[model samples]
Target: MSPTTKNAGGDRAGGLRGELTPRRITALAAAVIALVFVFENTKEVEIRLLIPEVTMPLWLALLAVGVVGVLCGVLLVRRRG
Candidate 1:
């Protein structure tokens, strides 16, 4: 098949089809790095939001921020696409 041709599964027959793209691999790697960073830091840290301060484990704070980041990314993608 030609490089530009598509298969029935809607994938490029001679290109990356049902395969992990560079973007996907990069995302996976970033996720792994983030997880490792989160898990490595277990110390209690004080977080300040606006005028309020709260103390929690660093891992929990990191996880929460990660979740919020993921949610924001999802929302933006959904709105645009």
Candidate 2:
């Protein structure tokens, strides 16, 4: 191999900038879709918490649930790995 083509410190030529694999692309797409789904729901919704009911924007509720789901996934992965 030519010296000009050799990577510095044995790192890839483009480093992480060239590492956008199919899995990263799919994850980006999923995040965009999830954001759209959450924002599209702008109507007010009533949520029942055992004995009390509360009203809030649907988007807020959806976003909160999404955050919780992501947190749970992260926790599970950390626990197992």
Candidate 3:
């Protein structure tokens, strides 16, 4: 009935207690990135800039893009409320 209390099976073997925190998600992402970088076995994709076209290693490009995305997200969230 209350927030602190759990009903029958609420805290069972397969309960929602195993929620993924931000730290866990970040660590998992880092591990996956490391694995991909080491393997370098991803499908090929082309990148086009304003002036020229370039071919790059997929995993390195993805990590770079992801870093940019994280920076933008942080800037947006940190803006005045």
Candidate 4:
């Protein structure tokens, strides 16, 4: 191979070498566990607010809350940064 092509391939391989570290593996495992937890609780339940009530599957409610919490966290971080 030419020197230019060899250098390019090495750079690309180096960029990907550290893509999966211990911390990333742990985060992936945690995400899988969270998904399992969300799917297992499939019962319906009542959710009460100030003046209204709603019935939905337990997993859906939990997933919504999780999404909202993540959005709030991202917003706070962005504001701080």
Clashing pairs for model 3 are none
Task: Please identify which of the two predictions, 3 or 4, would achieve the higher TM-score against the true structure.
Answer: 4
For residues 1-81, write the lDDT of model 3, one tens digit per residue: 678898766666674458798978997998688767745746666888788888876766777777787789888889684
Go through the candidates in order and give the clash count of each: 0, 0, 0, 0
> Per-prediction TM-score, please?
0.69, 0.74, 0.45, 0.66
**Tens-digit lDDT track for model 1 on 17-69?**
56798998999999999999999999999999889999999999999999999
Residues 1-81, model 4: lDDT tens digits: 765666534665655466688988996898788889999999999998678999999999889998898789888878641
| TM-score rank order | 2, 1, 4, 3
Best by TM-score: 2
Residue 45 lDDT in candidate 2: 93
Stretches of candidate 1 exceeding 4 Å from the true structure: 1-17, 79-81
Task: Please tell me which model should have the higher TM-score, number 1 or number 4.
Answer: 1
Local accuracy by lDDT, each model: 0.90, 0.89, 0.75, 0.83
